[model samples]
Target chain A: MKLFFLLTIFFSFVPILYAQVDTTTLQNNLYDILEDATTDKEGVEYYDLVEYLVQNKIAVNTASIAELMKIPNIDRQSAIAIVRQRNLLGGIKNENDLRSAEGVSEELIDRIISYLIFGDVKDVSFFDSINKNFKAIDFTLRSRGIYDLQQDKAFSDGKYYGSSWKIYNRFVVSKDKNIRVGVLIEKDPGEKSFNDFTTFHFYARDIGFIKNFVAGDFLFEFGHGLTLWSRYSISKGIETVGILPRNGKGIIPYLSSDENMSLRGAAVQFSFNNFNFYTFYSVRNLDGSIDKSTNQITSIRLDGLHRDSSEVAHQRIVNEKLLGISADYSFGEIGSVGLLYYNSTFENDFQHNSLLDPSGNSFDYFAGSYSFTFGKLYFSGETAYNKISLATINSAEIAVDKNFSLLFSYRNYPYDYWSLHSNGFGEKDGTQNESGFYSGFKWRTSYGNIYFYYDQFKYPIGDEKLPLAIKGNEFLIYYSVKPFRDTEFRLRYTNQLKESVAAINGEYGVLSRRKDNLRTELLYKLSKFIQMRSRIELVKTYATAISSEEKGLLLFQDVKYAPTASLSFSGRIVFFQTDSYDSRVYEFENDLTGVMSNPALYGDGMRWYLVARYNTSFGLSLSMKYSELIKPNEKTMGSGDTLINRNVDNRLSFQLDFKF
Target chain B: MNLTIYQLYFWLGADLKFVKDLVFSAAVKKEIGFNPSIRLGTEYSMVDFFKLRIGTSNEPNTYSGGIGIIYQFVQVDYAFFSHPDLGLTHQFGLIIRFTKN
Candidate 1:
C-alpha cells in the first residue's frame, strides 16, 4: 500500500550530475559495499543501485518491506519484522528502534546503516518536490574510448571495417517523474559503423491513476523470476539465506547500454486502492540465421556484433511480437498475491530442440505467485504452465531468533518446460530441466559467524529420453571471524559432484565430475587512507574412477590508496596457473568508473592493472586505466579472430565526465 | 622470601634461517627446582607486508601466537597467549620508526 506516491517521489531524485561528489571517502565506501556482492556473473549491472543510492538515500523511518528488501543482505523475514516494528512504534527514532525488531541482528544493522537516512521524514507529493527545487533539471553526458596495443587477426585480414578502437557515448536528462529521457550509443572495435547499437527510453510516473508509463524501451519483473525477470536478478553466491528471493521490482524503464534483452515498445501500470495492474506490448526484429528453404531459424545471435560478412548476414532476420499483463492485490501487512499471463509469436520456427531454447512460432504462458508473512516465518512461491508443461518453486524462510535463521526450497521443472524470458534458481540456467532440494542456515556465534548450504539435484529420464539420468550434489561451508577491531579473516570451502553425459568405452554413459574449492581471505584497514586485501584460492577437479584430473592455484593482493580528496588509486597483481581451460580461475578486477571486468586465467601467466581517478572542483572527472598480461614462453594466445602473436599484451582505457 | 614462593623464569632462543621467507627458532626455559621447558617456533613472511609466528611449549602446556602488519614507517603487532589455567590474554602494540642513513 506504500507504492502509490512514494515511487513517483523516488524517481524525482534523479542521478546527480556531479563527479561522484569529488571526495575520497565516498569513493572508498562505494568499493567496500559492492565488493561483497560482485562475482563473475554480477558486475556492471549491480552498479545501477549503488549509483542511485549515492545521490538519494532512503529514509529508514518510512521505508516499506519492498524498499527494505532492495538492500543487499536483508531477507524476507527480516524485512517483514522491520515493517511490523516500524508500524507498531509510529516512527523509528534511532538505532534502538532497529535493534528492537524481532529478526534484525546486530551485525545486519551495522552493515546497512551507511546507506540509510536517519533524519525525520514527511510525506510529500510529486509536484511539491518540483516546487521545492526549481533547479532540479539534471543532465549528464559521458564518453569513453578503449584501445588495444597489439593487433589481432581480424585487423590483419582487413575484414573489419572500423579502426581498432571502441567508442561509447551516453547521456540522460530528467526532471521529476513527468519528464525523463535516456539514450545510449556504442560501437565495438571491429564494427562497420560508428553507432552500431542504440537504445532509448521515455518514462513518466504517478499522474492521476497511472502509476507508470513508458515508451520506446522498458523492463518489468514479477514473482520469484520463474516467469519474467530483469537483467539484474539474484544468483547463488556467498550469501545463503539472504539471497533466496528475487525481490522483483515491477515495471521500470530500462536505462542500460546492453544492446539486447530489453523490450522495445510500450508498457503501462495503473493503481486503484489495494489493486495494481500492469500491461505491456513489444515487437522487435532480432538477429538470427534462417534457413531459406524451410523459413526457420538456425540460431539466434545475442552478442549484437556485425563485424564481417558472415555476421552481417545474420542481422535482423526474424520478427518477434509479445504481449503480457499482470494483476496484483495486497492485504496491508499480511500478504500479497499476483497472477500473470503473456503470449509471444515469432516469424520463423526453431530448427533444433535444445530444450533450453523456445521452439515453434507461437507460445503462451500463465503463472501465479504469492507471498505470506506471519510472525517470524515467511513463505513465497511461483508456478507457471506453458500448455503441456509446468514449472514450480516453493520456499520458506524462518528466523528462529536474533542470531540464527534457516531456509528451505524445492523446485521442479519438467524437461519439456521452457521459458523465453525467465531466470530462476537451479544449477542450470533458469532450471531448464532439473529438480532440486536446497536447505541453508546462517548462525551468528560469539566469536564469529557461520553460513552453510546443502543441495541435491536430479534430471529425470522420462518418455523424451535424455542422454543420461544424472544425479548430483553440492555443499558449502563458510566461516568468518574478526580477530581485531580492524582485521577480518574468512575461510570458505565448497565441493560439488556434477554428473554429466560423456563417452565411456565408446558409448554414452555418466561421468561423475567432482570439483573442490578452498579459499582464504583477509581484509585489514591499516589507517584512514589505506586498505588492503589478501587472498589465496585452490581448485581441484577430477572424474570418479578416472585417471584424468586438473588443479589450479591463484594468489592475489589488492591495495587501495586515497591520499587526497580529489585523487585516488587502486591496483592489483594476480598470479595464476591452471592445467587447462576447465580448471581456470576467475578474478574480478579494479576497472574504470562504469566498467567491470572478470577474466578467466589459465596456464602460467601474471596479470596486473592500475586504475586512477581525479575529480575537479569544476565538475569534471577524468579516469584512466592501464593493464597488461605477461607470459614468458607463450608466443601466441587466444583463438580464432581474436588471437595475438605476442608474449605480452596490454590495453589502455580512458573516460571523461562532464555535468551541469 | 619471594623467590621461594615464585620461581624466576628466563628463556633464550636461537634463530635458524632457511630462506628469505621461511625461518625457524628453538628456545629453552628454566625455573628453580622444576623441569625446563623446550619450545620450538617458526615464522613465515608471507609477503613484504605481513608476518606470522606460532610457538608451543612443553612444560605447563601453553601456546602463544602473534601477527605483524608492516606498512611504510609504521608497524602493528598483535599477540595472544593461551594458558592452561589463566585462560586467554591479548596484547597489542604499535611502532613507528623512520629509516635514516
Candidate 2:
C-alpha cells in the first residue's frame, strides 16, 4: 500500500501551480459560437455570432473586460490577461506583442488579431484612414449541403412537396472599412424552390457626414433594445456580469439566413461634432394567414417555412412599412443620451383573437435612452411609450474593487406594451408583460473565481395558456479555476422556481415548477498536439409537490488532435438519458466552420461525431462530418412530419469555403 | 457548451523479466486532466510456485503490495493499494485447473 500513498501525495499540490492560457478552450468556444449561428433562433439574440462590431470598435488600451467581450470568443480570463499585459508594456503595437500576455497562443492570435485595433488611432480623418488602409475588395464565398440518411415521415407521407436536401450559400465582398456588399440564399428541407428565402445588402460607412448608409436589407441596434434592436444581443445566462448592459453599435449590415426580422430599404446617419442624426424607412412582405371571408389577417408566421399548400398560400401575403428617425448627443466623459420615434403600418387589419393581440393597421412608438459612467460605476436605462402602455429598464455596473464587481438591472414591460422590434433584456422575449429585478456579482478569490446572479420576475398579465399572474425566480452560481497552465475546471449550478400552466393528474391551472441544473467540466492538454475534455451534467424538473421529479443525466468526452500543420480532427462521444422531454438536455456539437447544431437529447442513447478539416496551399478549405444517434429503447426518433420510424438516426453534412 | 476539465489520468503498463526468478512491471501514465504519474513494481519468487510483490507511486500518490501462492490444484493471489486521500483497497484473484482424461 506504500505506492498508493505516494501517488496521492504527488497530486495534492498540483492546484498551486500558476495558471496559463488554454488555447484549446478559447478555440473551442469560438467554434461553438459560429456553429450555433448556423441554425440559431432568437435564443441569446445570436449574441455569440463570433464577429466584430460593424462600425463601432472600442480602443484596445482603454477597453474594459466587458467592452472587449464584444468581439466574442474573448472570455473574461483572456480579457484580464490582455489588460494586465497592456499595463506592463504601456501599449500594444500588434498581435505579436500580445504574446507577452499569459494564456495566449499563436493560433489564437491569428484568428482574433483582425478583431483588435492595436494602439487606437485617433484624430485621423475618415478619408485619411480609408485611403491609407483601403485595398482591393476581399471576396469570400461559402456553400453548404446537409442530408439525413434515414427517411422521415414528412417525405415518406408526401406531405412535403420538395426534396429533403437542405441547401445554403452566401458571399461577401468587402473593402477595408469603406464598403461591404453581401447576399445570402437558403432553402430548408421540403422547400419548393432553391431561392425560397433570399437576403442582400449594401453598406457604406466612415464617410464625411454620413456615419453609416445602408440599402436593401440591414439591422439596427441602439440603446437598451426596448425601442429597436434586431441582431446580436445577449440575454441572461452564465455571463451575468456583462449581460445587463448592452453597448449599442448602431446600424449593422445583415447577411445571415434569418428570413424575416430585417429592415429592407434605405437608412443614413449624419454626424456633426458630438451630435448624430439618423433616418430610416423600410417596406417588406410578411408571411401571414388571412381570414378570407373578412379580409383580416389572423396571424403573422415567423417560422419562415413554406412546404405545404396552406403554408405556401400565405407566403408574403401581408405588407409592412416602417419609418423612423432618431438623434443622440454625447455628454460628459463616457456618456450619451438619445431619443427615438417610429411608426409602423400594416396593409391589413389584424384579427382580434385576444385582448393582448395587437390590432389595427398602424402603430407608433416614442422612446428615450441614456448611458453614463462615473468613476468605476456604469449606468444605462431606456423608457418607451406606445400610446396605451409603457416599457422601461434601468441597469448599473460597479467595480467595487480590483477583486469584486457587482451588477444590477430592473425592467418593467406591461402586457399592453408592444414594439415589433423590441429585443430588450427581460425574463421573456420582446420585453412584454415582464417585471423583474436582477442582481449579480463577480468575485475573484484565492481559491478561484465566483459568479452569482439572482433574478426575480413575474408576468403581471399572463397569456392564454397561463391565465393568472405568476411570479418566478432564478439563481445561478458559476465557479472556475485553473491551477495548472494547461488545465482548467468549471462548475455551474442554476435553479429556477416558476409557475406555469400544466396538467398533472387532471389538475390544470397554475402549478409550481422547479428546474435545477448542475454541470462540471474538465479540460487539459495531453501533449502539444492533443487536447481533451470531459463533462457531466444533471437536470431535474419538479412540476409540483404532488408530482415526481423528472431527472436527466448526460456525459460526454471530447478529443482534439492536430498532428499535422494542414489537417486536424475533432471528435466527441455522448451518452444521455432522461425521464421525459421536459428534462432533456440540449447539446451543441462542433460542425464545420460555419455550421452548428443544438439538438435536444432524450431516452437512453449514445451519439458520436467526427469532424475532419484540411487546408490546402491556396485559399481553399474542406470539412466533412458524420454523426449518428442510437436509441436502444425508442422505436421512433421524432413525431409529426419529422418522425423517423427507426431506432437509429444519422446525418451527413459537407461544407466548402473559399477566399480570394 | 465547450470547456475544459482537469485531474484525470490515463495509464499504460508493461512487464519485463530478465532473470530466472525475478520480474519487473512499470507503467507510464499522463494525466491530461491532472498531473503525470509513474508506478514501478517488481516480483520475486520465494519457492516453486510462491511469490511476493511490492511497488510505490507518487504527490498524493500511492503504495501497493501483493502475494501469490500455487499448490497442486488451486492458486490464489491477493493485493492491496494505499493512498493518502483514497484510503486503502484490497483485491483478490483465484484460479482452478479443470481437465478430463
After superposition on all C-alphas, the RMSD of every candidate to the true structure, in Å, is: 13.4, 10.1
lDDT of 1 by residue, A213-294 (tens): 8998777788888778755554455567876766666786776656666788999989897788999999988888899998
Q: Scored by Cα lDDT, where does model 2 land?
A: 0.73
- Residue lDDT tens for model 2, B1-101: 11123343333354666676787776545443233356789999989899999999864478999999998778899999896766898989999977562
Worst window of 10 by summed lDDT in candidate 2 chain A: A1-10
- Candidate 2 per-residue lDDT, tens place, A207-319, comes to 88998899988777767898788744545666667566775556767777667778899889898877889999999998998899988889888778898898899899989
User: What DockQ does predicted model 1 obtain?
Assistant: 0.02
Candidate 1 C-alpha lDDT tens digits along B28-95:
55432344467888779999999998888887888889999999999999989887787898889899
Number of colliding residue pairs in model 2: 35
User: How much is the lDDT of residue A235 in candidate 1?
Assistant: 49
Candidate 2 segments whose C-alpha is farther than 4 A from its true place: A1-27, A31-49, A52-91, A94-114, A119-135, A504-507, B1-101
- Tell me each candidate's i-RMS in Å: 33.5, 12.0
Model 1 misplaced stretches (Cα beyond 4 Å): A1-42, A53-56, A93-102, A110-115, A121-124, A128-134, A352-357, A461-466, A504-506, B1-101
